[model samples]
Target: MRQLFGNRAFVLLMVSDFMQNIGIWIRNMALLFFIMEKSNHDPVAVSLLTVIEYVPIFVISMIGGVLADRWRPKRTMIWGDVLSFLSILLILFVVLAGYWQAVFAVTLVSAVVSQFSQPSSMKIIKRCLPDEHVPAATALSQTLMSLFIILGPMVGTTIYQTFGLLASLISLLVLFAASAIVLTFLPSSVDQAPDTTESAGSLLKDMKAGFSYIASSRLLKVLLVVYVVLALGSGLVQPLDIFVITERLQLDMSSVQWFTALEGLGMLIGGLIAAVIAGKVKGTYLLFAGLSFLGLSTFVEVLSQWPMLTGTMRFLTGVLMAMAQTVLMAVMMQQVDEKFIGRLGGVMMPVFTGMMLIGSGFTGWYMSATSIVVVYFTAGALFLLSSFISMKLPISREPVQEEAEAPVSVNATVKV
Candidate 1:
């Protein structure tokens, strides 16, 4: 752990993530409640916020990879944060002018910018760290995410309720600005190869190759299917999450933060546990157990009438999901070609987000027609399907050692 933190580039990236994740949570809760108030807690309006959030990602994921590949990773990340800061600033003003509907734009802009910054982060982790450090890096990243998951809603709600939307927006702006500044301290790009925009056809060609590569690789193909199914499941439940509080628990809408915070708390502890057992566990088993039980947990969560039971299930889901993700990263690191890893992320992200977008789009209407419980029940079923499919994946415990691998060309590394 000491040695891992000793790497300056890694540290800077973590700091940037911390700041940005904090900002995201603040925006998520603050904007969420603000919109709920303006729209009278309409499910469609909230779901629309989700749909808008994913549109840019589904549109940009493949294209962002090409850009991330062409641009310096460090520069790409910094610019992504900067653009996010500026966009949030613009929306903050628009909100102040009484165009409260523009609040959804905040989620949309942040999600779009993240499509770039996120891929760049993966590239940086791949480049700066040695193979041995990957697990530790994964643990540290997930831990940070878990911490924020536990804290973001509470903090975002406190700020939003106490100081109002303006203050929350300002908080977001400052946090993003801080994150951008932190990223600026990251080391210069180690791979400063020239940009790969040779011609319009080159990008299309590379994208074609990326898809072809995934299709040819059975492991990658199975992973994509698992991801797409899980994404759709999660998305179906996400837009209706607040109702678990409003209708189920019979609590105020703002009380939904507690619901999420419990899940985050579970993840926080789960991160620690997963880190401990990561080396001892087979990555594939962890993936299967996590998703399988995660589905069961979600299935159980909506069925319970007690708030404590609901929170417990949420916490369990958090732990399982975090563990699942930690090992899933291991599986990817073990399975995917290193050169192709960046492209793999570029490819997988859009596919997952696209499916999530599909599920999220109709979930609002579905919930209106039925109830929140049915929506989550269906989501759980999808996850179970994903889990069953994941069982077909070939097992391997080795991590990819990039140094020993053969190289692919700049044209192939076309995405950021």
Candidate 2:
């Protein structure tokens, strides 16, 4: 961990990102609760609010990625943070004024505005880290982000329960402001201006090229397909777990909250393990092993009815999921070139987001009509199938040639 933090710029970026994630998670939890309260605890209305928050990402994330590639990443991220902060302030005002409908609209707009930042952040991380350190850095980032998941809900619930909805919104705004401040420290060199030569192409042509690149690469396509499958399978777990705990096991909301926290804790531990073992292990092997564990854990979860066993299985599943995700991301980052990273990210963002959206909707509908146990069994089966599909991909065991390059000082490296 000390070696990983030796790069001051990466450390600063991680700190800012940690704060931003915490704020995002807190706002999300509070928003769900607020919507429930305002609608007289209507489950359908709360679900609608959740849908509104994520729908924009599916609609606009591709454009966000394109803009990230065309503009400077640092500027893009700073502006995104600024817009998000302003949106939060507006939401805060509306909440304070008791205009619940207006708050919902503003929240949806905030979600749209925030989508612009993800590609730029992803590109920056790809550019800044050396090939050898990329896996470890990815693991560190995932660990920090997961750690926030444990705290954010607890803090948000406490604040909402104690103060009010307005306070929760204000807290998010403060965190966004802090994120913007930290982003400002990044050097101008990190931002890559759009290429004049590429400016002549039509939008459709450019988008096609991006898709073509991903399709032509065997490893990239396989990774993407496996991700989609995993996303679809994992989606069933959320609603199924909720039903099992609330309807079958008779656990209250507080217990559910704590169970979620335990899942986050497991992810944190898994990420830390990845970071510690990063350079010593092959990313492909780690990913494969993790996915296998995830499949087995899901099966265990589906069979277990006791609260203790269910919680343990959920925690183990989270750990394996985190390990798989971190390793896959690190491997993909190493495979792609720096110049096209943004465009590649743009192509991936929409696909991944769309898959999750589809998965959520499908799983929600399926669980509504069928038994929770059936849903879990289906999810576990899909996971096992995805693991088998993943094994068919040809992931290279050798490190990329760039991993042998001499380390450059942070001062000398371009920011973008």
Candidate 3:
């Protein structure tokens, strides 16, 4: 762990990632409540925020992957931060002008630009860290994310409640500026050779190759299916979170922060746990067990009206999610070739986002027609179903070292 942190390039990249994630969450929390208030808690409008945030990922993730492969990872990441900083400025101006609707538009634009950052960041990590340190790097990254999740909402909600929209926007602006500055220190040397062979037709072929790669691996295909299903279930229930706090629990907007904070705390602990058991435990076991625990926790939350119980359930859900996601990310980092990292992320974006879109859309309409509880119950069932299906995958108890030494490349023949 200390060795990973000692590397200057890795440190700078993590700093940039931390700042960007914090800024994004802070902005999201403020904007979400604002929309809730302006729309008078309308489910469709509130749900649109999730849709707009993900639509770009669905539309441009593939293109972003190709660009990440072709471009310098550091340069791509820095440009993404620059674009995000500019978007924050636009949001500030929109808020100052009292053009509330424009905030959502700006958020959508920012999401589109932000797609380039993740793939590029992953590419950079692959370059900077030795194969042995990849798991540590991933765990540390997840830990940072958990920290932001813990702090962002509490801080954002406080500022929004005490200061105003303008203050929240300014806070985001400062964070983005810091992120851009931090990212500038990242090494400019090329990490991998650019794909000079790419032509007009090459993009489509590259994309098809990514899909084929996934189709050929039973383990990859099953994981993808399970994750997509999980996203669908999540989309159905996530947007209803605000309603659950406010309407179901009879609490105020501020109370939602407690739920978020506890969840983040759980994630932080989960990350630490993943770090300890990284090489020893099979990712397959963690993935399935975590999903099962998370699903059961979600069901518990739906059944409870007590705030303390609900908060505990949310926290447990976070821990399990972090455990599952950390392992999932580590496995991907270990198994995939550096060249296809971006494209794999691109392929994943649409699957996750598309499922989320469906979940959000269905929840929005279904809740309007029925109730939140029904959606919760249905989503829980899906989670259990995903866990059950995962049992059939070819995941083994073998250490990630085995896979790291034998990476599956973009052009590898599909395994029957």
- Among these predicted structures, which one has the highest TM-score? 2
- TM-score (all chains, Cα) for each model: 0.80, 0.87, 0.81
* Cα-lDDT of candidate 1: 0.77
Which window of ten consecutive residues has the lowest lDDT sum in model 1?
Answer: 400-409
Write down the TM-score for model 2.
Answer: 0.87
Sorted on lDDT, best first, the list reads 3, 1, 2
Q: Model 3 over residues 1-416: C-alpha lDDT tens digits?
A: 78887988899987888778778877888889999998899999888998888788879899888667666787777788888889989988887788888977999989988888899898888788776677777877888889876776677788889998778888888888888788787766534446555333456666776666666666777778887988999899988999888877889988887788888899999888777676677667787888887778778877788998999888887877888888778767766667677877998778887898789878989998888788888899888888777676675433222132233334322210
Alpha-carbon lDDT of model 3: 0.78
With a 3 Å backbone cut-off (N, CA, C), the pairs that clash in candidate 1 are 65-415, 65-416, 66-414, 66-415, 68-416, 69-415, 69-416
Off by over 4 Å in 3: 29-50, 92-104, 160-171, 188-190, 195-201, 239-257, 302-311, 363-377, 391-416
CA lDDT of 2 in candidate 2? 74
Q: Report every candidate's CA lDDT.
A: 0.77, 0.74, 0.78
- Residue pairs with clashing backbones, model 3: none
> Using alpha carbons, what is the TM-score of model 3?
0.81
Which residue ranges in model 1 land beyond 4 Å of their true spot? 30-48, 92-110, 189-191, 194-201, 235-259, 302-310, 357-382, 395-416
Clashes by residue pair, model 2 = 190-415, 190-416
Per-residue C-alpha lDDT of model 1 across residues 1-416, encoded as one tens digit per residue? 77778999898888889888888888888878987999999999988986787687668778777666566778888898899898888888888798887767666777877877776787788778776666667876888888976677779899999999889889888988898898878877644544456433376766665666676667777888899999999889887788777777788898887878888888888787887776677667777888998889878877777888888888888888888888777666656654455567788877877788789888999988997878888999998898889888875544323332223232444323
lDDT of 2 by residue, 56-136 (tens): 766776656555655678888898889989988888778778788787788888888777787777777766667788888
